[model samples]
Target chain A: MAVLERSYKRYAGALSPEWSRFLIIPRHAFRDVFRSKLFTGLYALSFMAPLVFAILIYLRHNTEALAIMKLSVVNVLPIDATFFLTFVEIQGWVGFFLALLVGPQQVARDLTNNGLPLYLCRPFSRSEYVVGKMSIVILLLSSITWVPGLILFGLQSYLEGWSWFSQNIPIASAIFLGSLVWILLLALLTQTISAWVKWRLAASAGLIGLFFIPSVFAAILNQMLATRWGNLLSLGSLIRSVWAGLFGTFVQQAGQVQRMRGGVIVETAMVEPPLWASWLILFLICALCLWLLSRKVKAYEVVK
Target chain B: MTLDAPATSSHLNDSPGVITLDNLSVTFGGRPILKSLNGDLRGRAIGLLGPNGAGKTTLIHTLLGFHQPSAGTARILGSDIRGEANQIKSLIGYMPERDSFISKMSCIHFVRFMAELSGLPPGAALERAHEALFFVGLGEARYRNVDTFSLGMKQLAKLAQAIVHGPRLIFLDEPTNGLDPPARSRMIKMIREIRDSGQANIVLSSHLLRDVEECCEEIVILKDGRLVVYCNLEEERKANKKFLMLETRGDLKSFVEGIGSLGCECAMTSDHRLKIILQDGTEIRDLYKLAAASQVQIRRLTYKRDSLEDIFLKAMENGSN
Candidate 1:
């Protein structure tokens, strides 16, 4: 009897648990995203607003530094609900652009080259794949938006003492909750667009347009219909209304700021839609996004 | 010669099945792609062979839980595909019939990512990724971006990814789709080694009968979403009756009748050629004696074992029936 040669070696080790598999996607995605200089540069730039806010908090506590800069005590911005709301608004846009920059590179490349089968053939479910992609944007967006916003909130809490912190505890919650809603929305919308569009640049542009074009359409609908009902079409307004509701004290201040800027009547001039309506719209948009993702994210396209 | 035995020595009846389809049917749009497939495959290396529209790819996808069966169920590695899909997927590797890879990453990174997704720790995944790349003869090009690989290299990289996780079963769809003859031989040799090693049960789907015959132990033939033939290739070869091709000079009809009278099936294939299917007791020595006594010269004589092509043709005939 002759023996056969064996060239393949058997694996004797144990496998990792199934739950740990979902992290694999985001781990590789993070590496891919950070490999780009443009993404790294923009990611670093996104922190500029938060750093300014942090310094503003530092300066607000230092009356001596204000005097050195020849700025009056009255000129110093107070660390209040409106202040954090404005901070969130700025960081929200930063998160938006960051998501636009980062999100397309995540899913669009996977779909274009038919990499989903390689992924789906593994232990990953469709929802897990979506969550894995979503987690990358959420991590990136959170770093720029809520993570720093809460740090600034904590810094202000430390500087202003317990009395101010207790009286303004809602602002801290608002900062966290508001940034989460914003980033989650951005992440979902961007992933949705990236899932549908195969080209990375087109997906990125689609994300930007998902935000900007709606506002333009809302303005057009508002002008033609002569009703604030079209304000519902503006994602910015809907999200801001949710933010205003979260902050509680910023509704009046938001209206005043809009009056000061006096740009589009549909954007700031319109009062936040009924609070429930804003929440409902956000929920609907998120549901629509999830629906789009479930449709497009698949290993094989069913011809029927 | 020992290849006549079942490929795997394990007690297949006692061991868990590699795949079990219970009336598994899949329909796309309105037409059914896989119509009520039912079988239990226990072979260490199973070949899925079929013509166009034979539902080979659909069956692979349904086994991977990429497609939901219209009516029945499929259990892989003894796990139900409907509910235990992820678990089933964790146990098997799939090399789809297309170019599926993230083009931006190096070959190692891509394979490592696949291993990690298949439930290996990152460190172990990286180590195994390198080992797999080397195993598939892609060690030098492991650092090269996947898009830069040649067609053959890409196929090898796909194989590397499929085996990186040490899966219990691996479904390789058209593993040697586009390759030169040498590359195809290399791939077939690697596949034979994998099958011989018994590291993983392989389900190879291909239109090329030679590729299947080279590596697979058991064969399944399908036509029009239905099972045509499923049997061990060794048994099929053994059960086939012995046949001979002969070139005889002078009096071919009388020679054929002389063999026919001895309970053999004989026919003239051409003016000078005779096709003879010998019965159990008949032997080539008897034919030599008969030709000598009949004054017919046996110019050329060759014994022929049934090939996979013969089996495939028989299956196609059966499928038509």
Candidate 2:
């Protein structure tokens, strides 16, 4: 019917495919997410790390610029596994902050304003709803995390030649797969917190507390119990272990000297937790978050 | 605009009813909210009526696939709610009793989002969203955030979203709740127009008997999770006809006897008032002729029937039995 008629009319038009309907959630959610100037600024700021990394990679290959500065190749930071690992770590934190800002409000607003019935009453399932909300964080995080990291990897591969690229193929995989693990973990955790805590500020705080509070407790447990097993409580430590394992630098990073005493270097030789254990812990944490999300994301509560 | 188009699909099977409950039951924590509700509701506009705590909303929720049926299942538009819930959801729209809307979203945008979720393409969803907002008399305010709307406007926005996708069936729970008279009338008028448009079937659940009486062709009343009564209002109204109340000036006793002799049941409520149930083929002119013969001045004569309130009360009493 014409808009001027101002009456109910049957829409006999073609419908979108059923599988693509869930995309509508993220489409609208992205509109709301980008509306925040603070978030937009932070998101734009997230690309600075990759841009700096890209320039550094370019400088490594640019001998003329280096000669003009009268600096040798060894004087600058080496673009090794450590370099890419540090880049992944920095982007991971950026992803975390963005998730904290965007993820908490994804499901909380719907729950707080009684909007789930409007969604769940349509041709949308709870699983689809969760996936849609999770995609908001996933897409935003992916753009900053793996997407730019891969572009940087490709740039280095093109500049450094096939010999270095062939020798360090795992770094490329580590950049993509490691970033994915972190992004998925952050997305799931924030969404689970959003589903449980209907208040946005509380959900954001809950996400921060989930990461920081446990690390503090883990530190205390490690000091008192003298066991590295306590590190399992710390998500940050687990993720670092997993990332180090992914980059094949676990041995080098884990055996660093702790201190120097009495004019002599004191090497602690601290053995890191097994890589499998860290993977298991992260998987279990993600699983628990999924369970909590499934339990809380519903159209109505049954009060008995 | 005049609505003359036939419904695009006749997929709603009449024999199975628009909504068919097959021993449907729902329980929360061990207590049953809907206890084996079994019936087929087939009407252009079906009214679900009950007092508070009567499982009206629970039944709707069950049919919408929000609550799992503890015993049996229901079907909407020939699809099993359990097996084809998403398909059924695509065909149906729900306006919940309580306030439900996305905050900080414009009215048109909210409706458009809902339509998109129902599988409408973006452009069509937006177009329909605007038409729906305008149809609900929120055309001027479509761009305003939903959180800023008054209760009445919010109700209209809820309706706009519910109908934006051109659903085959619509479930409206408390559609006129907490509205002033004019807004309530407007809402009722919209409901009637939608029902008459024949583009969608309507299932209206409300406690107000007048609202149901005004809009519903058939009613299903529940009490204490039990089916209290299911009757066609049109048939009930027809059957309740030929009943009248009268006030007369003289010879009430003879007038009563004369009314009985003419095959009408008459009762004297007071010295000057009478309640008469006219038999079939009985005419009011016959009563007037009898009243003149009896020298009784028929001062005030009024037609009376069992109203929806009376029907509801009788159902309540019978349901208690």
- Tens-place lDDT per residue, model 1, B92-211, is 888888988987899999999888888777788898888888888898899999999998999999999999888889899999999899999999998888888888899999999999
Q: Model 1, residue B222: displacement in angstroms?
A: 0.7
Could you give the interface RMSD of candidate 1 in angstroms?
5.5
* Regions more than 4 Å wrong, model 2: A256-269, B1-14, B242-301
In order, the candidates keep a fraction of the true contacts of: 0.71, 0.75
TM-score of each: 0.86, 0.90
Q: What is the TM-score of chain A, computed separately for every candidate? A: 0.88, 0.92
Worst 10 residues of 2 chain A by lDDT: A251-260
Mark the 10 consecutive residues where model 2 chain B has the least summed lDDT: B1-10
Q: Model 1, A1-304: lDDT tens per residue?
A: 0012225655567788766667777778788788889989988888888888899998988989998998875787877889899999998987787787788877788888889999998878898899888988888888887788889989998998999889988888898899999888888888898888878888888877877898999889866654456668889978888898899853422242223224544334544457788789999999999999999998898887
**Candidate 2 residue-wise lDDT at B217:** 91
For each candidate, give the TM-score of chain B: 0.80, 0.85
lDDT of model 2 at position B45: 95
The two-chain DockQ for each candidate, comma-separated, is 0.40, 0.63
Q: Candidate 1: TM-score?
A: 0.86
